[model samples]
Target: MASKAGDDPDSLMSLCTIFCLKNLRRTMCYSEGEQNRLQLRPDVFLPGEICDRLVNEYMDLVHTDSDFEPQDGFFQLFSDPRSTRLTRLQLREDLVRDRDLEAIGKQDLMELHLTYCSRLTARGLRTLCSFRHSLLSLSLFGCSSVFFRKSGAPLAAGEDEDEEERLQRHTVDLDFSFQGFNRLRLLNLGGLRAELDVEKLLRPLPALTSLDLSSVHLPRPAFLTQWSERLASLVLYNVELTEELIHMLLQMSRLRHLDISRENQRTSKFKMTRKILSSIVQSLVDLVSLDISGHIMLDNCTVPAFEDAVGRPSIEPCKSSIYPFQELKRPLQFLGLYNTTLCNVTHIPAYKVLSFEPILRLLPQSSAPVSQHWATWALYNLVSVYCEYFTVKPSHQIRFHPKIMSFSV
Candidate 1:
């Protein structure tokens, strides 16, 4: 069936406002069951079962240019207590400003996600405090301008700080408090280029579980020990990984996801050793996802000694040497090792690093030209010592080379 969106010039684009907004923060929300009887009958397609109140309550926003809703009319809508019952909203845009937050402040929202809204300042954060008591999840990634600067902010993430590396520090007087966030669980403050009081900010939220502190400075990550019993997942992308921080992370017995990927943008004083990697894999028994991308190391770091892991397959047919390692005891759903030396190593059974049959099957099945091309290369990379089981056929002819070759089903 065709969508009910009409023949208007902007037929393709439509807006929706629901109680639950899906993102990295899986916030819980409850509908208050309040209906605005004063709202005029809106012209909409036969609304679905739950659509009557949830959809029509905010549909007045559809007429954006004040053609349908006048200033007094908006005031009327705002004055009604029911209008302030919105629970979930994600307003992500460079154009979002402080005034928009002020308007939203009236509502006791449960979840709010705003990323890259650069125009927002400290005043906007003040408005956000209105929902501090009720909010369950909040993500303010890349919205650093909201903080007032003190000394220079955290350096551009490295062992050595350059003049341009300096980032602003948030002073104690930002007029914000985490004290009332009793129900808050998921918090993503990634890309906040400020020297945040890591301990003070987190000491209040006893319920916080999943946190993404990407690009944020944590000179004193001792807070990890405090939250060890509660914190479950963490993303520390581009943040410095010191030995102390590593030790603190190992204590989080409940931690499931850990992404310490450096992306090669900066330098970490600690080079990830095979020993350290093995220790992490062995200790963090509950870990479901682990990423160690871009930290420099020569030896095979992650996959330890086990037999259940599939045999390492290669595309180059060079079985001259195989770094023998056993399978990991636990199951990891995701493992990210991009931009690392392991980019070419395909022995990780946890991630199915480079299983032979999977890459071969993906070749013809991949319909897109780019996908087919990469699948062909993946096949090229899987030339095992035992090619007796598999036959190299060209869906088309190829100038095959002994060392490096092209492949087809």
Candidate 2:
């Protein structure tokens, strides 16, 4: 009796029958209450839950196996704006602990701006300095914690420490003794307000091209003068640009760009006069561009002198009598004469004037690689104003082209 086909106690169920029973139970238990608790529809939750569960279950298989390649799970999770903002602190902490993970090969990462990151302390920065070999740019713009706050203590008689110890204790002392980044191009230490020895920092960076010490309370020009050949661009914004500093810059024949704005603290006889400006420009024969804006003391004469110096020929006249006949062959290509009425067309050579106004109109029409918005605007305005002075006849087409002439300022 017990050995019957369907009612036998020892009889086994077929695979199809077992699968049908499991599906039936799953369908019956799939309710809206469960959907509501998970805040997702059953159709949506089912696939997502299955994917997450599978990933967790096979995590080792995916990570360890040479053939398996998983998607960027971290990027998928943190790409959302909410997730980015919420987890930034945690991410920073994790990055600090796993410093080696941030080393993404031999790419220059100079002037890193980690502003408002409270957890990024001096120790963290010191750790990050391991990348100094490839790091030429570093910008800790609003990192108040890394900056020095004056400690109200008098000098101790017995404590004589080394450069590394001094750097750790003092905010201004940047001890970069660990060498490797020989190709550092630009260093912007703005808002640090520390007393940094410019020479010490520059000594390590043999390939340094630009240095911005805006509001950094740096030492005298002598420190910079030591590495004049290596420094091509110098920004002393809101810092003091003394006569000595100007002379130092003039002596640096390789310097191409110099910004000495009102941010300079020293009040010296560094007038933007015709003779002084011309002399300064004349000294930098290799300069391709020069910017001296935001200094209210500069007058209209400064413009002509700048143009004359830039347009002057690299080769000096043999005698004073041959000066008038000396012609410039390579004039400065880019000159920033912003915020000054000194752009008097009469002072510049007729053939050497390249107005920006016409160039601006032509830029939109042309297919050249003019990318920067501010630079485009500046070119447009410059050409437009310069074109106003030139009387173009209806029969004659007015063209604003960059002038090519020898260095004869």
Candidate 3:
């Protein structure tokens, strides 16, 4: 018997509804697959309407996909108390290529290290600098772009236009001023040979503690006199060293560590004399460490005699008055006399020795033949032991072992 049309209408409606549902399910599956392929992580869930608003407002600056996201483990490593307040961000050679740096904004950044970043350029640096106030510490070690001009002659003195025009033309250079960092402590401009206005650069950083200008040309000695006494450490790698420069550095009475290794080179024409070096050393009454190695002048000089003479008592008459040069009252620890032609092992100074193996090898003919292999092993062990012990306490009981102390015979 055939069913009536009205009675069968409910069953027909049910069949149509099932077909529509199946299509809707397929569409939903396709949409999900597309979303997954995009590789978006679970969205950062906002707690309330207020949070949602704030997050949406700054969504572009925040939210990163899995590849761009900062690893939790890496973040945890830098979450220590020592590294927490570290406003200076160092982008090492390994991390420089990472795209994650784009996510890092300069909200509280004070310093930045872009050492050995061959790919980094002035344009990118300008962009990075725009995020923060003028960076306090800007390290561009081994970065060639920073030192040399890309094209054309160096920016001339209004050779092209008026003040407004010049300003517009060199907006990037003007904005690259270091004036914003009044509390800057350290600046490492190693390998930069640009004609930087040292006085202008330093004027902003009144609280600078350390300055490294290795392999870079600096302004006149007169300019260094203007440096603040807060400077505790200074490294001059391979630059001209004059008596005036030495005197200017002497003005920094609070300087504790000074590396004038540039003066120790064999090919260096401007060799600092024993008298000048000794005078400079004497002036730094508070100096706790000093390194002057690789220079022919120092190489030829008698190490023991030089050390003893520098440390000896001497009465000298000045233009106005006379004063006695007493032994450096501050413990002159960690002296690096490396690459010098000093042969006598017994003459080596008795401070916490880092490397005596080199000196041992150069000992007199009477001394036993030093085993090169044993010396290498001993040096490694000494460094390891010293580092371990020092890591525990940086300032106390810094001593050497007898085994490492055993010179030749």
- When superposed on Cα atoms, how far off is each prediction in RMSD? 12.0, 19.3, 18.5
Give one digit per residue, the lDDT tens place, for model 1 in 222-301.
77787788888899988888888888888888888888977453467668776677667666778877777667774654
* Models sorted by TM-score, best on top: 1, 3, 2
Residue-level lDDT for 123 in candidate 1: 62
Instruction: Return whichever of 1 and 3 wins on lDDT.
Output: 1
Candidate 1 local lDDT, residue 167: 32
- lDDT preference between candidates 2 and 3, better one: 3
Question: So what's the TM-score on candidate 2?
Answer: 0.48
Clashing residue pairs in all predictions, respectively, total: 13, 37, 3
Better lDDT candidate (1, 2): 1
lDDT of 3 by residue, 1-409 (tens): 5556336875654444333223422321122353332211233221333222222222222232333332222222222222223354555442343222333442345566776654443444545544445456667676544322233334323332332343333322433555556656778777663555555545666667888877666657566655646778888766677667777887888888887664235557666455665576677777766766544453233434544444322212121011121244533454544444431323333243233334445446775444332344455466556665656343433323332221221
Best by TM-score: 1
Candidate 2: regions farther than 4 A off: 1-119, 139-180, 194-201, 262-270, 297-329, 344-409
Give the TM-score comparing model 3 with the true structure, all chains together: 0.56
With a 3 Å backbone cut-off (N, CA, C), the pairs that clash in candidate 3 are 264-294, 264-295, 265-295
